[model samples]
Target: MSGRDYDHRRQMGGELIIPALAVCFTLYYFTTIWNSPWTAQVSAFSIGGILLLLCAAFFIKTALLLRSSEASLGLGGLVGIEDVRNGRLALVLATIGYVWLIEDLGFTLTTFLFIAISITALGHGKNVGRATATAAVMSLAGWAVFIWAFDTRFPRGWFETTMQGLMANG
Candidate 1:
């Protein structure tokens, strides 16, 4: 194959992939808003506007990439596609299990397990000790940010009462 043929193939692949992704996003955006129970006119308009903006942005990006000459459609540039595929599967399974375990184990336990498993699965640690420490710190940081800074309430699971007591004391 000639150089021009290879470039044409690459460009065509890029164009195809991006438009497909944009179409999927558009479909999801419509489905979500259509199914949502936003009965109030103002609420429906707000949600619809946001969804439209998201879809517009996705299509705009795809269009820009398709117009660009420098873009390549091949997956070769992205790192750890195989690892990511495996990691994603593991993440999904772990998320489901975590939801089930939350009632029995509590939020802290479930979150910690999920974070550690996810980080490790994403090819985080060559050293066991380092990985454990990193996971611990990340879990703690996430907890602090969500609970303290954002004032967001997560499912406390079995620890609900205890967390409430702590919050009251604080």
Candidate 2:
């Protein structure tokens, strides 16, 4: 294909992707709001509104980038296409795995694994030790924040019996 054709195709693809993502985000936001509990309506509304705003920002950024002269050469010109493709695949896989494991592995363990896998897959392999340590720290911090600060009851898996006994005697 000619350079011009390739450029036009790239631009068109960007244009389509941004709008599609925006539409999906809009639908998701509305669906979440609609399905939210009555008691948590205000909280859900606030979160949904924030998500919608973020999605709008992403849409605007994508549009602006696509309109720029650099987009003619495609996103490959800005960021290596191979890296972007790999990163995107990693993100998709991590998201799917997180959803699948959320019930069986529980939120804490699944989130930890998800973070580690995502970081490793997104070209962060130079410091495996550091990445693992950081993932562990971050995961524990998240667990503490959600369990203590929010008073949320995250599933404790098969260890719940022992944990409950400790809590009861303490």
Candidate 3:
């Protein structure tokens, strides 16, 4: 099959949105940090430049494929055909919920719950034991590092408040 004779409807055209957004963001970031200190802006500028170049290359390649009638705007097929799409959506919603509840649940509990839920959801209920153990270890390790090693003051919630009250009374 020649490049110009292929059906345009089955190509991965929908994947261009991310690169487009990255290009826009890189441009905006450069404009905002153009006058900042070189040391402060150096890393961002370098990364942005690289991102811009890669996005340009991808966009150009996609455009060429489209122009040659070798690609179709089959965005629906790309995301709709995936079996793990629902899992991905669930994980995203869970993440948003995790962030929203962090203040009320506090870091340790919220993080632990989030990690456990994420692992289970992404695993599709398979290997439940492994997911649970990994989530527990990861959550506890994160908490230890941030609270004990780094002394980061996470927000107080029910657990923290109850512990503090108990310590004060005892």
Candidate 4:
């Protein structure tokens, strides 16, 4: 790569969207934590500051590359998959399905389905048993940690209610 011609523009400029969104989210997080407790402020700043630094570095690197005509802000790399069936579109649709189904299905069930579907989609429909097992494990862990331990008010569907009753009884 060092000896190769450097004039070729990179097609992955669309990848920068995530870092840009991170910057915005960190700014919003900063605003929210300003009026909170000192501990919250410290934690928020600790993480958000690191995120900002990383985003700044990425922005500078991208700027240098763009200035040198080595990268273009084109969506082709992200959105131009020739085979739409097996590419990013499937992942996007899976995410949409997850979001659409989460409320009724609850976190554990929705997450299970999301992870299973996403793994199958990404793996091109292979690994059915492993994907199902992986999804079940991940969703149960998420439920145990986030829902049970932390007791977050994530929309309570049948699983959450049943678990709540079981824990209360036992």
Query: lDDT of each structure?
Result: 0.64, 0.66, 0.76, 0.84
**Candidate 4 local Cα displacement, residue 50, angstroms:** 28
Candidate 2's TM-score: 0.51
Q: Which candidate would rank higher by lDDT, 2 or 3? A: 3
Q: Write the per-residue lDDT of candidate 1 for residues 90-169, one digit (tens) a residue.
A: 77787899889887766666787877776677654446566567767876676678765676766665545576589889
Best by lDDT: 4
Regions of model 4 farther than 4 Å from truth = 1-78, 83-86
Ranking by lDDT: 4, 3, 2, 1
Worst 10 residues of 2 by lDDT: 70-79
Q: How close is candidate 1 to the true structure, as a TM-score?
A: 0.43
- Backbone clash tally (model 3): 2
After superposition, candidate 1 runs with Cα above 4 Å error:
2-8, 11-15, 21-81, 84-107, 144-151, 160-170
Candidate 3 collision pairs: 8-71, 8-72
Which wins on lDDT, candidate 3 or candidate 4?
4
Clashing pairs in 4: none
lDDT per residue for candidate 4 within 48-163, as digits (tens), equals 89999999999899888778878767664466655476646888888999889889989999999899988987888899899999999999999998999999888668899999
**RMSD (Cα, Å) of model 3:** 5.6
Best model per TM-score: 3
Query: How do the residues 1-170 of candidate 2 rate in per-residue lDDT, one tens digit apiece?
Result: 57775555444344445556766776776776686778757766776667677767866766676576434424443335665666876778789988888777766677778888788777546666766777788877876677545757886543333544666799
